[model samples]
Target: MHTSEHSIMVNGIPIQEDDIEYASRSLKAASHPLRLKIMCLLSQHEMTVQDIVDHVGTSQSNVSQHLAIMRDKGLLSSHRVANRVYYCLAESRRALLQACSSLR
Candidate 1:
């Protein structure tokens, strides 16, 4: 194994440092069960906070906190629609979600 400032070489294959960092951050954010559930839900389509709370059978406040964490970690993106906030997996993280879904 060999490492450089921008990449790592394992078995003669180089992996970009940025990709590794992104994977680390995304995995950490989604490691929580509630957050994982939210990601799986959003993998299907964008949803409002209330919708996620209803589907996850949790309190709105609980859902909001999880959403905030995921948002801060760059695993999710959100926008306002009138009085509602809709959230979806970040574009860069969608491939990660797809890879996880394939395991199910």
Candidate 2:
């Protein structure tokens, strides 16, 4: 008996259509300049909302909104400690961020 397996491929690499939608969301989440800046900062270390506001030189409310978007996109993870919440790039997204940073 002979059997064969076939898979959809892109650039010689197998890929799923669903992956494109997910990638698009991540890319769109990082498209904003503020979000990109936040990603760069978070890439170094996790930070509280206030720490992000201080480093990014933006209003807390604006920073919070952007953080929410990134968080929703699965690009970032958050940890709550005491009265503060810290945010950082999700482990899986870190390499994607590194590739993005290199583009600049």
Candidate 3:
């Protein structure tokens, strides 16, 4: 990463306004313990809401709410198959997640 008079480079890529906003949102979304746990779980593999509830030991509604929040923040993405929804971390935010994990 390098810095210019007006721009910052990240891994040889120039950082832009949208990139800054996205990183900030992703960090905020993963700041919560439950949400961070969810990210850790999903980092391993995509999981259904029931699976997340079981792993997080939280109520389904609570897990669903967190999932929705993360999805809205673009830190997570979901797809439906049949009656179940599966979620995984967005590829763009995986590096942020790795940084968060190292802080643990």
Q: Candidate 2 — worst ten consecutive residues by lDDT sum?
A: 1-10
User: Candidate 3 clashing pairs?
Assistant: none
lDDT of 2 by residue, 63-98 (tens): 999999999999899999998999998898897888
Q: Residue 87 deviation, candidate 1, in Å?
A: 0.6
- What total of clashing residue pairs does each candidate reach? 0, 0, 0
Quote each prediction's TM-score: 0.80, 0.86, 0.89
For all candidates in order, the CA lDDT equals 0.90, 0.90, 0.89
Per-residue lDDT of candidate 1, residues 10-103 (tens digit): 7889877687887798899988989989999998999999889889999999999999999999999999989989999999888777787789
Of candidate 3, the 10-residue stretch with the lowest lDDT total is 1-10
Which pairs in model 2 have colliding backbones? none
Runs in model 3 deviating more than 4 A are 1-4
Q: lDDT tens string, model 3, 10-101?
A: 78888897878877877888899999999999999999999999898999999999999999998899999999888998898788878876
For candidate 1, list the clashing residue pairs, or say none: none
lDDT agreement of model 2 with the native: 0.90
Q: On a 0 to 100 scale, what is the lDDT of residue 58 in model 3?
A: 92
Q: How accurate is candidate 1 locally (lDDT)?
A: 0.90
